[model samples]
Target: MSSYKKLIYFTLLLILLVYSVQILNIARFPSQIDIIKGDSRNLNIFFPFSLEIMEESSDIVKINSTNAERLSVGLKNSYNLESTNNGIAKLKLKFLGIFSIRDIQVNVVNQAYVIPGGETIGVKLNTKGVLVVATSEIQSIDGKIYNPARNAGIKVGDSITMINGIKIKDADHVIQLLNNIKNNKVKIEIERNNASFTTEVLPVKSKQDNSYRLGIWVRDKTAGIGTLTFYEPNTKKFGALGHAITDVDTGTLMKAENGEIMRAKVSSIEQGKKGSPGELRGMFFETDDVLGKIENNTTFGIYGTIYDENKLFKQKQLLPVGFQSEVKLGKAYILANIEGDKVTEYEVEILKLEKQNVPQSKSMVIKITDERLKEKTGGIVQGMSGSPIIQNGKIVGAVTHVFVNDPTKGYGIYIEWMLKEAGIYVNNNSEFAEGK
Candidate 1:
C-alpha cells in the first residue's frame, strides 16, 4: 500500500477505536429509572450498534426505536419509552449480534405534591453531644506545653458524648467534668465518622487559670438563617437548606439531637461578590414561639415538623411539586424573603437542567434575572440557600448553592428529593385526580 493511503487508513482506525471505547464506557444504564405513568422519556444509545429488547417485565412500559437505522457504524440511535400504567418494569437491552446485555429497572409512579415555602427562618441546631472543634497546647503547672486531647487520640470533628461514664450535656458540663478530675486519667466516649469508640485522657492542671484542662475546644450548638423549601401539609413535615448544615469549625454535619426553627426578619443584605459570598443578616428574637422542631440533618437538608401551620400558610399557599422531567430551561421564580417576614417572588432563568436518575443537590443551574432581586441581594446569597424555585406555577426545586465566581448563578436541588428527605411520599395516581 502507498504511504499516503497507509497513513489515512491508520487515522481512520484510530478514530473508530476511540468511538468504540466511548460506547463501551456508557454501555450500561442506571440501576433504576423512574417515570410517572402516561409519561414518555427518551433513551440515548451511544454505540454504533443495533439494540433489541430481549425481555420486558410489564406491559405498562412500551419501548419503541426512534432511529434504529442510525445504529450503523459510527452512528448513534435513540428510543422512546412510555409508561402506560403504574408499576415496576425490568428492561433488558441486547446489543445486536454483540452478545452484550444491559438491564434497566423502571418504576412508574403517580404524581406528587408539596407546599412551597420561602419564608426566611432561623436554624438553631444542638449537636447530639459536644463536638471537638479544635485542640490546643495547654501550659501545665510544671511550665510544660502539653496536648492532652491530641495525645489521647481525640481529633477534631469527634463528638464527645460521655466523659467518665457520664453523659455530657453541654460545653459547660464538659468543662465541669474535666475540672473535677484530679490529675487522673478519665474515660471518654466519642463518636467519630459514624463510629463510636472510647479513649482515656489525663487532665492537666493549667498554670495560668489554676484549673484542670483537656486542651480541646468544644461546641454544643450552631445557629444560622436559611430559606425554607417546602412543607407537607398532610404530615406537617418541612424541609429546608437543600443541603446539610455542617459545623462551621469542624466542617461536619451537625447531628441534630434537638433543634428548632424560629421566625426571622432580614435586617440587612450584603451583596455577593466574586470569591466572597454575601450573607443575610437577620434577627430571630421570638424564640418562645417555636415554628418547627428539626429532626434529621442529612445531606439532602434538614427535616422537621412545623408546630404552627397557620403561621407558615398565612402568607404562602400550597403549590404543586414539579418532577425532574417537568423542569425546563426557561424563566422561573424563587420565593424568598429579602425583607421583613413577607415572602416575595423574584425572577430567575433556568440556565440548565441536569437529568439525573439519582438524587443530587445540584439538579439545575439557575441565574438571577430579576433586576430588583439582583440589585437587592446581588443574586443568590448565603441565607437564600433553600429558596423554593417555582416554574409554571409549580415548585420544581430549591436553591442549594451559589457560584463563587458568579453570584448571579447558583445550583438548585429537585423538590422530589427534598420531599423524600421529609418522609413524604408522592402518590401520583391520587395527586392527578386532585388536579395537583
Candidate 2:
C-alpha cells in the first residue's frame, strides 16, 4: 500500500469516532421537570431541569433511591429539595429522576372550621333570640279543645309570646323547656302580625320516641329567602338570602375580592333523583354585577341586597314571608335571567321539602324539566347561586351547587332560611297574606 492509501483509512476511522460521540450525547440528556414530590418523607423539590444538547461525551447520571445519591459522571442540571413535613423523604433530580416518601407527620389531619353543623348535637345559634318565621300562622300546641293554637286556627305565621306562662326566648331555650316540661296542660301566648292571643294545650306523646312532644317545630336559626328576614316593615327595608355563601369543597366563604356574580343564562335544567339531584347551567359574563349586596353569609346562602323593584316575577306575584309554610313539594318554577335584560321563567319540581330539623341547606330537592333551560346550562352551574326558587307561585329556595360528574343534579337553599337570617319575618311570622 502507498502512503496516500494509509492516510485515507485513518481519516475514515476518525469520522466514525465522531459519529459515535454524537449518538452518545443524545442519549445522556434529561427531560425538563418543574416539580416533584421526593421519596424522602419530609422533602419536596422543584426542578428546572431541561435537556440542553446531546453529544457523545455529554453527561452520565443515575438516581439511586437506596443510597439517596445522584450518581453523576458528567450530567449537568441544578436541583434543590425541601421538606414540608417530618419523616417524609423527597429526591429531586436535575439529570436523574425524582422520588417521594411520606412520614407519620405527613398524614396528620387538618382541623378546619365547617359551617353550622358539628358533632356536638343541638341546634346552632345564628342571631341572639331572634327567630325569623317562615309561616304566617302561629305554631300551635294541641290542647284538644277549640284552642287558638290548633293547627288550622294557629295560622302559619304566628309568633309565640310565652310558653307555659314563661316568656319564650330563643328556639333553643324553647326546646330545652319543651323537653323537660312535665305539665300536661300549659299556657301559650302568641302574636300575629300585631295582635296577641293566649291559649292552653295538653302535650301529647311523640309517636317516634314516646316522649312528650310539641306538635310544632320551632327554629332558633334559619337560612332561607323571604320578603324580609328583618323588616323595618316600617322602614320598608328588607333582607334576603340567609346562609353564608361558601365554596363547596373548600368550605371557605369565597372572598368577595376574588369572586364576582355575573348574569348567567340557563342553558338547561334536569330533575333531581332520590340521592342524585340536578342543577341549572348558564353562560356567564364577567361584566354582570350581582343583583344584591352581600350582607350576611352562612352555610345556607349569601344574604345580600336586592335591587329589583318590579317585585312580582313574570308569572307569579310576590308572596310575603308568612306564606312559605304551605309551600309543598310539587310543581314549581324559578326566576332566572336566561335572556338579555329580561328575567325569564323556568319550570322545576320540589321533590322533597326538608323540615327545619334537617340540614337542607340544599333545601327543596328539585329538577329542571324545561327543554330551553336544559340546552343553556347543561344543568346547574356557577353564577346562578342566588336565583330565587319558586314553588306553588311562592318563593321557596335558591340554586347552590352542581354535581361535578352529573350536570343534571344540583343543590338548593331554602328561601325561608335566607329571609330568616335577614330579620324580615320576625319570630313566628311564617304566613304570607296575599295582599299587603
lDDT per residue (tens digit) for residues 197-249 in model 1 = 99999999999999888999989998989998888887899999899999887
lDDT of 2 by residue, 1-436 (tens): 8999999998888766754563444344222111112221112222212222112212221222222344433233332222222221212223334322211111111111111100000011233222323322222233232222354344444556577777666676765666678546676776654467877765554445544544554443332222112222232333333345433332333322122222234454444334444433344444443333444545664444444422322232334331333557677776555333346567877676554422346655677776677677655544445556655544556666656666555566765555545544333321211012
How accurate locally is residue 395 in candidate 1, as Cα lDDT from 0 to 100? 93
Model 2 residue 327 CA deviation in Å: 2.7
> Clashing pairs in model 1?
110-428, 111-428
lDDT of model number 1 = 0.83
How much is the lDDT of residue 101 in candidate 2?
21
The segments of candidate 1 whose C-alpha lies over 4 angstroms from its true place after superposition are: 1-28, 48-56, 68-71, 93-103, 425-436
Among the numbered candidates, top lDDT falls to 1
